[model samples]
Target: MKKLVLLLIVLVFACKNETKIIEKPIEAVKAKAKPTTKFILETLKSKGFKTFDYVDTKTKDTVIMQQYFIAFLKSGPIRNQNEEESTLLQEQHLAHLGKMYDLGYADISGPFGDDGDIRGITIYNVPTLKMADSLANSDPMVKSGRLQIEVHPWWAAKGFSLR
Candidate 1:
């Protein structure tokens, strides 16, 4: 083991060059292209926040997330709902959120649940949290006592697009 370790160390030292040495494959690697920030521009404009970048005059801010937390209740009449009722409720839940666009909300998902009555809460990115909060407070889900909403800060660190 001692001899093996000594040999390994020698091999490593022999392979390393102390000075800059151009090798056969040196030209193979080209400079990598910088990441584009185009999507960020459009997202900011759409949300009504004006954006400016030092590198480009046209790039938008896509990292802004107008988000909200919506909670739903699973107990009550829905406590013992059938498959048909379950499906209908699912549709209604999504449609209800979609309707919130009239009140200015964006990027919504889930009335999802895992146990009991299966409540769903979703996060949305909007121009302002107030709009989302108001929508949630006036939401049929909230009014029905089967849902609740909380507004909070949200952001997209990089890249933007509907998945």
Candidate 2:
């Protein structure tokens, strides 16, 4: 694996109260993935994962492609009922992910809560849409009934180049 450095610049552009639509062609930047994004995905997989989707910049497919998927995972007495055991399971999962991906990571930046419910957004690299499509269906978390993960393609642009 190659060591990639991610440089992020947080730029705040003043915006009036208005809405607009913008389009960026993938072919223009398909040859390479952003350094920040590359690092993030790599670090995250190191934690644990069942499947991964390496996005094809040319295909224009991403978690942001969807409005935001709602997935009902599991948090029941019978599911990962043992915290210690669950911790081991999670560690194993991350180890597998780290071996599979280069360096994976994700950032949760915002004031949001599940209202007593546990929820979070996850991102990973995929080679294509099909890969991303299969992840949720076969996530280890889902299979073990320990985590209920769903993909919501609508990624906030804010954390794009997070360091």
**Candidate 1 to truth, TM:** 0.43
Q: What is model 1's C-alpha RMSD?
A: 14.0
Instruction: Report, for every candidate in turn, its global Cα lDDT versus the true structure.
Output: 0.54, 0.43
lDDT value, residue 112 of candidate 2: 29
Task: Provide C-alpha RMSD values for all models, in order.
Answer: 14.0, 19.3
lDDT by residue (tens digit), candidate 2, 113-151? 664445333454443334444654464554576665545
**Every model's TM-score:** 0.43, 0.37
1-163 per-residue lDDT for model 1 (tens digits): 9999999998777666532254434533433444355656676677764345443247743343323334333444323556776666657766777876544455555645466455655555555656657665665545544454555655543234666
Cα-based lDDT at residue 162, candidate 2: 62
Q: Give Cα distance to truth, residue 135, candidate 1, Å.
A: 1.9
